[model samples]
Target: MRSADRVDLVLRDVALPHLEDGHGGAGAGYRVDVAVHDGRVVAVEASLSLRGVCEYDGHGAALLPGLHDHHLHLLATAAVAGSVDCSDATTLDELGARLRAGTPRAGWVRAVGHHEARVGRLTRDLLDALMGPERATTPVRVRDHSGALWVLNSAALAALGPLPDTPDVERDGSGRVSGRLWRLDHELGARVGRTAPDLAALGAELARLGITGVTDATPDLPRATVDLLDGARRTGALPQRVHLLGAATAAVPETLTVGPAKIHLRDHDLPTVDELAARVTAHHRTGRPVAVHCLGVEALVLTLAALEDAGHVPGDRIEHASVVPPALLPRLRATRVQVVTQPGFLSARGDDLVRDVGAAEQAWLWPWAGLRAAGIPVCGASDAPHGPLSPWQVIAAAADRRTPSGRVVGAGERVPASLALGGYLTHPEAPAGSVRRIVPGAPADLVLLHGPLEAALAGVPANPVRLTVVAGRVVHDAG
Candidate 1:
């Protein structure tokens, strides 16, 4: 903790891995002593005799750059973490029991990860019927796998007040409002009470996975949520750095720097070409790059077209370009857009994707190698709550491409463990999706793992993180 000429901290006898090729190849990494002073890596050499206020003997563990998630929904992930997990419920009775057992916030009970085939046709009527009499007044919400649809009970509808005749709110043929919502939970959730997961606890969870920073991709983040995160970060309650991108335009606190403007485009709700172009123009005019959410090929094509017309901006981003056809790769390369995707999705939903997209197109689904070959920079993200949050698990998935069903997806797109890990590195200027190497002059944000890089990446006992330092501050120390 010493300031001035004395080093703040010193990591001794640490091995660093080098990427052989910029595109998924590994090179030999040598052991070095990394010294930090005033939150920046001051020195990295084979040996150093300089003394420091505090020292951690690496014991030949791999010292890698800290992980960064390019696309995350922190608040949503936190909310889901605290909700009743319906992810594994297979029967309607099981789903009902799970919902009934959940602790309600105020008078509402929320559950995520419900599939129609498993839970039967999820409808307001079915939910109300399942509740019967034990929970007639308790509001119930069941969300789907994609987080796009929500089946709400009658109690929830009443609690949220009169539903306007909006396109997002689903209604029956008889003018009766069905308690089904499409991408409008944010509005409905506001009516009910809000229960936020402990930021400190969540930060600790992230630190354990060696995550040092995250780019929150939640659109139109509320001011209250921003204030809550900022306070936690300032007080050291939240140790990870947070970068936010939302639809609302507001002056954020210094703790929360302004990020790109977000435009969400889904398959069901397609925006006209003009509408899309207008949004791109508006964000570009305000000196902000646009981050578009595209999940399907249809959405990807439309988004690419808009970016093509709008021209390339330095920081324009494509969130979850999950399906980029080979034919369209050339168009995407022509733009300065960066693809921030979740390779973990292949592990979580690979079976469904392969089934939907068919075998031929499945090869292009979440293609890391194709993007790299097309001259497009790709960054990895958890898209948490929707996907897994473990950095090591995600990296392994990127390398293995093995799904929960033991099926290999996009075999040709599997990246080397080094390049997969390098996807998280952040650059100073283009901080959004750029990769940085672990060298002197870089911010001293790093993680110390239990073994060599290759062994860790191969999932051999899954290398546990021994220490996590963010901006030179020791956030997590397992030792």
Candidate 2:
């Protein structure tokens, strides 16, 4: 902490960019010199003279803050490993070819996007038809907007035996497991999946995308997962800061310290007002904010009620606040819950979203505007394999409000790309512990995009984020 000793690192002559300015700047964007000491930004300005072993030349490149995946299933995405991709087809016929050609093993057969009009409604009839005699042998699942299920044919059924009443199943006239399932949670046991990428490797992956940190979602924060990350940190492999999150209902783990609890009452439908209120009250008393997984409108309403009853106030992060029914806006306005969403959802599932939910159902898609207009603070996430691991794509989806075909679904809910960056670039909602913007006093968490901001956001055509840096470390170097 000596005055003569500048800091551990400094990023010079860089153009720092921000999604928005808070308070003083009203979304005041930044692009300038950045100085880092130890691990924190010491000062950010146009020019700075500092003595440090390591330095990054901004060269007028666009530097952004760290990106966070506020509400995500990163483990699931990671398990995908970029291999089996069903994200492109507009019809099941196309998917059928892909499936029959080289289906990955036989575990949970899934179709990413199946539009109703194009492919029609997916019922047990389709499952029976697809599986046919093999339904007795192979287990398959198709994932539409409504979720998915394993098509357990007779052999598969005999193997597993009578099914449980989870996911609100749709049965045939004779009243048998239809395989056309709803709510994929109940049928599956307490399945906790995580892709524990090598710490050094993960650091490199995140850095390439310009991410400096991420808040992993979980029921019980995976000790093994964080342990791997911790190991990476010790070995200089871990790339960014991490803010761990555990389910509110979980028994806190000792290995991790200081993080929010993840709440997902919508899928499981537990945590009545009393239960939620009690939990929030207790957690707030602990002096920590709770991040609720409320992607449905009904769930969002109930969440607000719980927060209010618990005597909790603003700054409590609300994840996936996508299903806000118009009526709830005024009420949400009265609270301090920050509305966070996965902007990448629009394009993530490709045609599947439109297929499963139908355009009418997608009328509100990832309602970014509704949240912003209500003055509810909002943030963004890539949602990864479910989407992609890049903020630029989120920005493109947010700004364009359309699909790859140039068709708009939730036009009214779109946010300007600049503003959406707040989630990926500025809002604390994303990159929980990730770096952001190249500014002095801030660790160099930056992205070198191929083009300028406007061009990067011009939809599918532009290539963004050629380089990513975190804390003066070159995670992704397009150069």
Candidate 3:
């Protein structure tokens, strides 16, 4: 082949996404060869008569557009690598042993994934006893599994110095600080001192999982955090393209694209409907859409009301529409707002929901098929650190809706495997819209799985990826 016909890379004998049947079966279509050059697909044919600087035999495996995690906390996901995970602890002793064994970071022991169901309600006194006398001087902060609350030891409270005068800071009957803070991530971080975790490892993990892009949905991100993410992307510490949803005033660097303005609503401390509507309008006036965090029915109702009052924008989204009662479905559909949900929550917290939530409410928890059938656009996300990070695990959860205990939470909510996979194939800006396909002139970000689409979807392998390419550059190869 002439130099004009040469390309940067070519993937031979791979099945494309369009060839997959609606039910996850491999439809009748001959495997095709794809040519990539200058970060975009240049040619695709039954047999590409072209030369490539590098070539790989796909062995009739499925080649798909790289996955995009629609909503997750990038910094928290990276930071979780160093924190003790209390997710699997079933008793107070197990939780205490985990926290005690964890090494301290700057004399602070940070733990995450704590559940009141498993270890009971945590307080400063309980944490003090859990840490024991030897480590009494060390401060500790344990985050609830919901990521909405934080229980801190007395040492942790004292280490932070003066507390902010906010109702979020809980107090006991004696008017003493109870060490349980609700929806105070920013306040706590400011007092604790912010530290950006290295993104190199996180980047590699994402590549291994075939993720080519992500949306950092951390609300009201500080300027420092924005700069950190931009710098990481530029330095290739984080190679995946980023869409950052942060403070309205955040001056986004060119390295990162600005996403929808994030509006976080807590049931315990919700803004009035009018106030929330004003906030939405303010962001919309500046030509930016708003992505509201609504984990409870109350918050969801408030958010829907606010959206109706403020009117909707093209990219406006409802993040984690975690509890969508059937009554609210019509209202939600009327708003025409897209929902970016985390199916991983079912696998991660479904059992807890079964035990704690009322049976009537449990049926509507993270409704996937219900939302889709209602004509409401929907997308899947990991919501990492609070939920599982792997998109495969998330996809499986969407198809099965099975909890850790092997019980199906919402059988009616389960969607086909192809539909679950389609969630990750969507463009970040147009999530809940059409899925991106491996066509000529599209970005060369792609994943080659170990087997065909049918086999991979059926087995849900832990590491199904055979190779991952980002912008015509090989980022990961299983070999």
Candidate 4:
């Protein structure tokens, strides 16, 4: 072979997904050599006679497109690394012990993944007692697992001086601040003055999980956050390509792709149908689709009605669609609104949901197969910091629908492992659309599993990836 034909990299004897049979089944895939050059796949055949600048013996491992997390909060995920994780704390004492053990950062103690069901409701008095007198004056804030509320201690609340006269700031029976703040992220962040976490560690972790791309679903991103993300990408601190769902289209830098306009809605503060319709129309008029946050039935219904009034755009989506009753399946299908859901929620918070929403309503929570059967485009996401971050863990949850207690949350809603995996292989811009494949012209972003697809996905290994490549460069190599 001519020297010109030499490729940048080559993987010999790797199995590629075949159309003849379903993934992981007998005789489902065929083995061949894949060559990459200039950030794209250059050749695939029985044997590659040409030499490569770099080569690896796959030993018949399955090669697939790198995973993409359709929805997540990158900054929050990074920041949570430093916060006290209370997700595993079942009792108030356990939660308090964890919080007290965590060293304060800048004179503040930040905690995350707190569940009200496990520890009951939190208040300033309760936090003060939990922290003890030694740390009574230290500012403390704990984020609910739902990512909807912040439970601040009296010290933390006092640190802000005066509170805004808004319903979001809850008050106790005596008309004093209750220490519960709802949807006040901007206000809380401004007063707390916490700096952004480094993205390098988060990016490396993602590459290790074989995630080559991601869609940051943080709504209404400030310009500073956007600049931080762009700088991270440019400096290679963040190796994954990102799609921003909240950045203004015109203001977005060329390095990052703009996604749908994010509309955050709460059932308690829902807008009128006309008001939501107008907002959707405004976004559509600007040639931008909308991704609405709909975790409950009421919010989902409101979103569907707004879409109907404003006319659904091609890229319109419903984030979380967490609760979808049977009656709304037809309406959801008719709207052509894609759903980007988090199956990991089942594994992370299934028991709490079972207790809160009841066993009868379990079928309606994160209905993956049901939505797909109804002809509604559906995809899986992690919703990290709120849910589990590993895509493999998410895929396992999707396939088994099992909670931490080993109980299946939605038995009928379980999907095939291949289908669950396919959700992450889709284009970020069209998450519920076609799955990207490994072809000669495709980008060289790929993952090489440690074994055959069947074995790798059998129980969803903790880390099945042996190698990860992005833009023709090896980002991760287990060897």
Candidate 5:
């Protein structure tokens, strides 16, 4: 289809009603007429004229604000979406079946989703038993994000020789070469797509999922990847706005509301706090916000300290405060920092969290309630490809707070659905726990659900994205 010459389209659905204010205010829905000239939104109206190439349809669906996956690895996630996935393989037998059937190749031989903070240990012997000498010379490896790895057979071990030791395999009764790989899965996933991705393909997929934007967290991933994405956007090869976090380059803007610094406070430290703090301070001095990536306890402190030292306040979002300690909760809340969290993983981890990390930390995992009570800003996130990137699922996970096995680790930590949506960093300066309602003058970024917001969120597991509109363009018509 060619680009429209005049007013491009009008999309409307029965359920695309305006969000109700909840004070006896009537909720209203508008028929969105998107005027596009040169592929950018010129006007969005309840009704408008069409000079050429007009399309009108929302098909009795629902429409709301466009969704965003604030934390994601664009290139890697896109590539992993196609690789041999064993994320469903729950036990040794299942993993073995996958290993035997897939064959001996240097290509990614494994796919795992269960977070390492949950699935604790899988021995090399067990992995070897799974391979059954079929590829004793071939490599066999498995990994999780939280610094644990299990490698089986000589080939796999040799291939992984250069990687750092892992507690799952290397942890001895005392301390020595235990032959295990720590957080090997996460490492492998990060390594999977060192090659450049087709950003055009990724952008298309994002629109399909009701996503109009992304706050890319994988900053040090590869310069080529972001360049491709940025180039694509400039050429209209990609439509979404990319907020790339440049962890290595000096070209990165110090203070940016849309694009900010990507700092990781997690296992396998790389960049120093002083470096991060400098960037935060630079952005703060310029009156802009920076987004950070923090997944572990220690990293969180480093991030907190850097921000405090710089005298920078909380527009600096410490996204994915997944493992913050209770002691730091108040400090995090008291500051101007906000958080973007993925409760779905916590829900998926279930009892394994207790088994691997112990009860206390598991209970403190993704502490949403304490943050909210302390007025700490927080937003819901999917961290897609690792978690489903649907806002409904994110909202439900945050509200329900139940793991895959029906276990609730810190039951009291769940936040309300409304509050969870409020924290999305998709839009600049949007407060935590607030919705981007469709108002007349607002930019036309809308999504439609099949039911009421509350009910739709609760039913996300049963349904997916219904319709997605970005900058007034109906990019996704799920029906």
Candidate 6:
């Protein structure tokens, strides 16, 4: 390597996807030599004479901008990776067997993905009986995938002790605690603390899949959680850039830089218009964006109304406009709300959605194309433990709208794979309207795939990421 032309890194003979014509056809891209220096692309030419400290032979592989997940609960997803998975248990016996097999940590036996229909109703007495008399004293907790309900044994409830007499706590016909806790995750979590899996290792795993950025959309992020993420990033444990959306109220840190104030709304249980207006107005006054979680038509409508009344601020977002109808498109566009949607929901829970959502609202679920056509900016997300975390799976779902059962949910809303991939490239510097591309002066956050651009966009290949570079540094290299 010659010192006169030295650069940090260079990739020779890489196929660069045409910025606009990505996924157009078999030969939509051209080959170029790219040089990186000081965390940015310094050169891209048909051929380059520069010497690099590290030179990689792309061998004609496609090189593109790195991916991002616009919405995900980082801590929760990491926790799910280590939690006992009961998603496959089809009967009470099976679930009980799994529970019996679980090793309690800190006197708590926790499990996730509990399905009542398949395993029958779970109750305090039922859980106690399942544990058998010898181990009945152990505290046990099991949460369903929906994140709405939790079933706890008597010991578990006692551990938390003398809970507030709130509607979220359930009781049986005999006035005994039913062991079913509703929407009290934050409360329960406070007691359990941060017993999640290794967050640094989880971030590294994401890097391997070419994810260079993510928004941690965990509402009401506690100080401990925030500090944990900050420490990880400082120590280089986290390679992806993180943006955060907090709950209605949270401490805003300078470094973490709170991105939005998250408002969680449920169907028919929404706050009054005046209440919503007040919150939105206050957040705007404080220079924080508002991100509302609206999954049903009713929730979406109410949320849109609130945003309209408050007057849409620049960075305002709608997290999941899950069931947006054509009638609401004009209203939504007028609000100028940016949507962070979960196309991965179709792949993860499409079957249940088909059964639950009425025919009138069927096509409205995950209306990315419709939103895009309405001039509303849309970003794709993997709501993580709630949805699959794989960016490729999310892209496929957006492009195909196909469920695991092979049923297409909303064929009319299907988008070209390239367009879906572009959704992940929206960054603070690039914003919504700005074009995302790989060229000189752009940040060298990129992924090198083992195929041509057209092939990748037709459908993302499993295990396609050969290398991931973030800010000119190779974060993951399986090359």
RMSD of each: 2.4, 4.9, 1.9, 2.0, 5.4, 2.8
lDDT of 5 by residue, 1-479 (tens): 22333554444333444443311122445445544444344555654555435454555445556766677766656655444566666666666677677643345355445243333456666566667765565565554543234444555656555556433346556754444564344454454434544667777777776676776666454445545665677665456655665444444332212445665443564357788778778877766667777777877888887877786554577778878777887678656777777787766555555565767788777777877677676666667666665656677778788877777778888766655654552364443534565544566666656555555545743555666666555666766
lDDT of 2 at 189: 25
lDDT of 6 by residue, 272-375 (tens): 88888888999999887788888888888788888888997788898888889899999999998788888888988787677767887888888888888888
lDDT of 5 at 128: 63
lDDT of all the models against the reference?
0.80, 0.58, 0.87, 0.88, 0.59, 0.80
**lDDT winner:** 4
Per-model TM-score, in order, reads 0.94, 0.76, 0.96, 0.96, 0.76, 0.92
Q: Who is ahead in lDDT, 5 or 6?
A: 6
lDDT of 5: 0.59
Candidate 5, after superposition: displacement of residue 427 in Å?
0.8
Misplaced by over 4 Å in model 6 are 1-3, 21-27, 117-121, 171-176, 247-255, 428-435
lDDT of model 4 at position 30: 89
Candidate 5 displacement at residue 469 in angstroms: 3.7
User: Residue 54 in candidate 4 has what lDDT?
Assistant: 94
Candidate 1 has its poorest 10 consecutive residues by lDDT at: 426-435
lDDT of 1 by residue, 224-317 (tens): 7788888988998888888888735565787766567878885787988778988999889888888899999999889888887887678888
The residue pairs that clash in candidate 6, if any, are 220-247
Which candidate would rank higher by TM-score, 4 or 6?
A: 4
